[model samples]
Target chain A: MNELALKELLYKIADDQLILGHRNSEWTGFGPLLEEDIAFSSMAQDKVGQSYAIYQMLNQLGEQEPDTVAFMRNANQFHNCQLVELPNGEYDFSLIRHFLYDTAEITRFDFLANSSYEPLAQLARKIKGELKYHTLHANTWIKKLGNATEESIGRLQGSLNKALPYALGIFEPSPLEQEIIASGFFAGEEVLKKQWMEKVELLLSQTQLNLPDWKTIQPVLGGRVGQHTEHLQPLLDEMSEVFRIDPSAEW
Target chain B: MKFSKAEIFTLLEDVKDPEIPVLSLVDLGVITKVDIDGEAVHVEMTPTFVGCPALDFMKNEVLEKLKENGITQASVSISFKEPWSSDKISEKGKAALKQFGLAPPMPAHLFTDIEVMEHVPCPRCEGTDTELKNPFGPTLCRSIHYCHTCKEAFEQFKPVS
Candidate 1:
């Protein structure tokens, strides 16, 4: 059990959930429909809550408290894939991003449920069930709108094309990837990416969406290594604004 | 005053869920364990949903109830040691939820598909001709549904395996 490998793995997972959870929350009042609004907000709560739980695991391993870690981090410190931090452009883009990202997320956690790390395995077991609804929501809309109108199909296709490269970034190999895998902490990102591709392909096949040649797209990497887009800092600033004002204030 | 583990559980029966007041924490199946060590009581609980906002309130309520019963040296800890599933909700809790106008979840073992959410029996009319409007609801642990028979919307405490 390499502690550093475990922490690195935990940090990336937690950061991904936290950032995307914040993005999902942006749809709270702005969903195209009332149910969609509540749906995104609910998933946001689930994701953020899941991140907090993982952060607690890190804390048990000697990391800072969850609030301080979440609020105090600069954009460069975040390990979330750039795909998640990208602005939710339109209903089509947001929905497509949700579809692409959650496909990988559910698969990742499913593998993680069997992690050699017991604490992580237990947490992943719990999280795996909650993610079902997130995937269900994403799949439902992708099928419905993906087959609905010409405009709907075109818009989704455009977003899908735009998001795939960044979505591929989700599996950017950790520096300790082999150690993490050999230690049984995880099965590694390569295995996860293969399964993710399969799942994504299956879902899109059920719709009118097109997936281009996988080999042609160069994955926009580095998010797992603390590299992120310009959008992240502003989002972090806004997210931690209230906390920075009074770090010790009880909410 | 030393209480036995069973006795501690009995005392916890009075601690109701803050959101669903009709349901006790014991009945809701969140009280995973209660141990008595000397004069101190240790209660281990798990949340129905990890992100449930009512978790802290429920934990405090359990502690407050123990103190109100004169057990001052008590502690409560939250964990996933015994992760909660919808199946853990006792029959009594299910009845209480129905009476409180919320449908209880079906057994998680019964279905692996999201379609299981469809056609749930309406808590109001006990009619199976219901529709799953949305899988997400007002709370993390619930889902919104509509009863065609009753012509009204309701929420179900969703099943999570």
Candidate 2:
């Protein structure tokens, strides 16, 4: 296996979970409803915890400790797609984003469950089962809000349109995509993207939301190669503030 | 200085889940394996959830239990080698969970459809008429449900396949 390619794959996966987990945590007290609040907070714990497990795998492969890797990185050092870092605009946008992003994630982890890499495959298999609830939560809300009142439908549709481009960024190909696929470390992003699109389409078809032409929507890329939007640095700064203040402090 | 695998498991049975104190790690099925290596004992375990905060505490408790049992040279490792599922929970653990006012998870085979979560039997009233309030709950391993019969909300130890 190409060690660099493997690390890159792991880093991107871990970063996505960490960043989105932080965003989910932002919903801790602010969800539109009490259940939604607890739901997001719970998912936040799951995602952040999942990210920590992945980082531990990275550390075994010669990266920094999980805390250092998670808390010390600048925006440019992160490998998360831009989709996750965008501020939770509203309940509508957050729900749409969650639905789209989690669909891809569950699909990705499902593929990774069969990865040629033994350790990752094992972890992925376990993580895959846990993510069922996450997708269930996302799918339920998307369908409910997507087919409800005029305001609810309009808001969800608008957010879905706004989020699609960045959601597409999730599949930005790595330079070593072929190598990773060939080595059986992963099935590669393109395969994941295709499967993800099908699943997304299937779910949205059940709702009142519309899917726009794929060719017309440009994917907002660059997050894979460390280029991120202005929103990312501020998130990182806030996320790591407590850790940076006392790196040596025991929790 | 040496202990049998069964003896080590017996000691570990005293170490209950920090969150659900009524259930032992053995009954909960997190204690995947116990190996006796001459004078040193090594145990393998897996967490119910990837992000369960109680794992470290569980590991420490295992160590402490072994030490109190006079098996000082013992070690515990958390791994995904034998990944956990709700099905792994022993019948005894399920009863204990219910006794503790938390519903045990449905069998993994019956949990393929997420709809099963919507009508979990209430631990408090054993009422089948229940509604899933949320799939996520106070802890990573639980889900919230409301029982129409008892007019109370309860949690279930969520089933993870």
Candidate 3:
């Protein structure tokens, strides 16, 4: 294994999950409905927990402890795709983002479930089970609301169009992309992006939403190499608000 | 006799799930193996999910329960080798869940079928005329459902695949 390549891959995956999990948790008491509140929080816990497990794996490879790594990292040290770091602007935007990002993540986990790396494969297998419902939840809501009413459909369509460019950033090719692909670690972001497009296209076709010619969309990249939006640092600061207060205290 | 495997196994019944106190770990099928050597005990378990938050608390409870049984030297190990599925929840656990106002989990295979929600029996009235409030619930392993018959809402322990 190209160890550096592996580390890079892991960092991006873990960071993406951690950041998005935080965003999802923000809807705990603020969802449009009670069930949605619970659902967002449930998925939030799963995503955060998934990130924690990945961080533990990184620790085994000589990274710092999970708390230190998660709470203390600066914006430049992180490697998550920018799609997950954006604010949950509204229910429509948040839902659209969830639908897009999870479509790609589920595809990634499916490939990882069969990975040559035993530990990652094991973790992937378990995570794949959890993600089945998540994607299912996203799909059901998209189908229900995408064609429901003028307002709902219009809102979703608007957010979907707005999020598409940033969603494309999820496929930003890493420096070790080729090596990671060659080493049998993963199929690379290229394959994942292709699979995601097909899945998203199929799902959107069932609703009133219209997907623009994806090729025409300009992908907003750079989050993978640690360049982030102005939104990320504030989120990080808020996440570490309590942790930084008593780093050494056993809670 | 100092502690024996069967005795330790029986003693483990005292450990209850923190989230659902009505069911014991044994009843939940979380306890997979139990071995004993004199006063020392080794117990093996599997959590409902790989990243389940309750894993640590469950293990500590098992250890604590063992000590309460006068067995101090105990080790509780976890593995996803035999990943937990909802089918493992015992009949007693199911009954306990229903009586506690929560529906027992459907089989793991059913969750993928979408039909699992179409007929979730209400724990409140045992009514089949139920509506899915959300397929997601407060916990990772639960989902909310509403019963039209009794005008009540309940949670179902979702099957962990």
TM-score of chain B of each: 0.96, 0.96, 0.92
Q: How does residue B33 of candidate 3 score in lDDT? A: 89
Residue B110 alpha-carbon offset, candidate 2, angstroms: 2.0
The most accurate candidate by DockQ is 2
Model 1, span A119-218: residue lDDT tens: 8998888888888889988998999999999999999999999999999999999999999999999999999999999999999999998999999999
Task: Give me the runs in candidate 3 sitting further than 4 Å from their true place.
Answer: B1-6, B35-40, B113-115
Give all TM-scores, in the order shown.
0.98, 0.98, 0.93
> In terms of TM-score, how similar is model 3 to the real structure?
0.93
**Model 3 over residues B8-75: C-alpha lDDT tens digits?**
76788878989999998988988988877766788899877665899899999998887777777889
Ranking by DockQ: 2, 1, 3
Q: Model 3, B63: alpha-carbon shift in Å? A: 1.4
Candidate 3, A1-251: lDDT as tens digits: 67888888888999999999999999989999987898889889999999998898899889899999999989888899999999999999999999999999999999987777777887887788888888998998999999899999999999998999999999999888988888888898989999999999999999999999987999999999999999999999999999999888787
Q: Per-residue lDDT tens digits of candidate 1, residues B14-37?
A: 889888989999999999988777
Return the clash pairs for model 2, or none: none
Give candidate 1's total backbone clashes.
Answer: 0
How would the docking of model 1 be graded?
Answer: medium
